[model samples]
Target: MDSLLALLKKKSTGQGSFALENIKCDFFISDFDKPLLYTFAPFGEASADTISWGFEFGKNLDVNVIAISLVSNESWYQDPELYELALNLGKLANFSEILGYGGSMGGFGVSVYSNILKIDRLLLLNPFSTLDPNIIPEETRFRWYQRNLEWDSRFNDGAITCSKGVVVYDPLFKLDALQAKRFKDFKLVKLHGVGHQIPMHLNKLGLLKRLVIDFLNNGSDFAWFYKASRNRRFYPGYFAWMQSQENIHLTQRRKATITKCQHSLKKLISSKPGVDSVTGKDIDFIRDLALDNESKDLMKAKMLMEIALKLRPEGEFLKMKVSSYNKRLDGPDL
Candidate 1:
């Protein structure tokens, strides 16, 4: 049950660390000349006691970093303690530029506090505008945490304060799309099938660093983002999520969007022809494709699984999938 600051201080004892109520902040000074990056850690059980998001990324770039995290999930950062913390942090003159970055709950913090922190720019991914149920009645996803929140307070609506930043989100996700509408001033990058975990998915596709660095350094490059986003087609669970949407709640536009994505996937698969063999590197891609096909075409799933297993001989999950498909295929018709 160690505090985030305590856990972080174990590795580097001299760094600046502070805790006020449920909020914690850690400061790492890499260079006096480089811009400071403020990263807000998202809400999650696994990362509750870890350093804020973008710790290593900021360290690698030799920039000053302020890592902020809330120890408990109950507070959606509505604490008055933040204003006091921001007032002190805003006085530092080492940073030439002050930028904010965060995702989900973290994104909410970055946006809401941008003006007070004197943030020059920001990068928010799938951030909620406000957790106030009255304002966002359609959003029913986080009721457990929302039940006891003090929503009517200063700096509650991040959409009002977050004027300069890029907001990346999956437009096909109804709730996220609704959230995006609140950030009217910021530029929107609608990435369809990547879901709410936009940053993670982009990282998997080897695009997160380029996307983030380019934005924080040079504002934004829409053409570059669009081109890079197309690589989602090759992501492991991308097509599977797209194809499985029939069972989920989707807007009319989202349904049409998925249909278009399915068309593009079909063309991509057709161009690649058949998977004759798979190398160690290709095993994951092949395995994912196999799983995607399991519901619709068991025969094709079996073939791809066989190809993947040849490269990954010790793959127990692949063996199970292959066996299950074989049994279903060989059974008599009902």
Candidate 2:
């Protein structure tokens, strides 16, 4: 540890600022003396949900690792201490490389933190810019979530000078204007297969060491990531896509959420739960409706709701949605 940095850390006492407050999270600090890499996935309203980034490379990066997490969908903004804690961790760790990790909403937090934290490299997994006004257009249930993460210019480099940023997401997100050149300065690697999660036995820590070794030796890893098979990019399997969409929908933004189920019948059942409003068909629609809103796919949510009601009866989640679309649909008034 550098003596100057040590002294500075000593002077900075008390609680560190954190994004979430409701729960005390587990903060894992590793290899503090070397450049430190920090990772987090803040789910906001969908905090409890889980998604894998399929990075068999997590352990291969070789740099110091600091993993901090709040509960699922729990707002870090609720507790400024978590922010302070993060900063304090950064200070105390004296990290040369600050890396943020996340996908979906977790991706959004990593981007937002780049402004406040001095980071060197970032591996964002399907990150979202939750607060960007564009989020509203999705009309997915997740578009309207806790007010804290709404995109504010503050996190934008235009407003706040931030470190280099990079994104590793599904191009399907189709977000450019909201973050034009957001990662132009950084190395952006899009994983087509989703690389949602590496197998459990990928020697996490050793792999991380290898990545750091490559980065420090040459400052590049296109070959390294490829050679080590650390960059295996595979998305959710057929059934997983269907489940993931629902999993992602309910966990994060429901509007932008989608259905991975290629089966038309399966999709229909997921999207429509009721048989007839009063006559009652089936609750199968709940599966799709939940998956839609949870994944932030509002359009799908509306579609599923329409089919569900057409088949059976209206329910809680749909009632709220139908009321909004009432002016257009003459089917049944809320």
Instruction: Please name the candidate that would achieve the greatest TM-score relative to the true structure.
Output: 1
Instruction: Residues 1-334, candidate 2: write the lDDT tens digits.
Output: 1332344365431222222434323232334455555555445423323322222223344444434455645453333655565465554555545666555555555566655566666655444454444533542435445344534434422213255554444332334223323445656544332323221112221133333344444355455444333222111242343244423423434323424323444445444333323224344544365456634543334445555654444466556655554433222100
TM-score of 2: 0.47
In model 1, the clashing pairs are none
Model 2: which ten-residue window has the lowest total lDDT? 197-206
Maximum-lDDT candidate: 1
**lDDT score for candidate 1 against the true structure:** 0.70
TM-score for all predictions? 0.70, 0.47
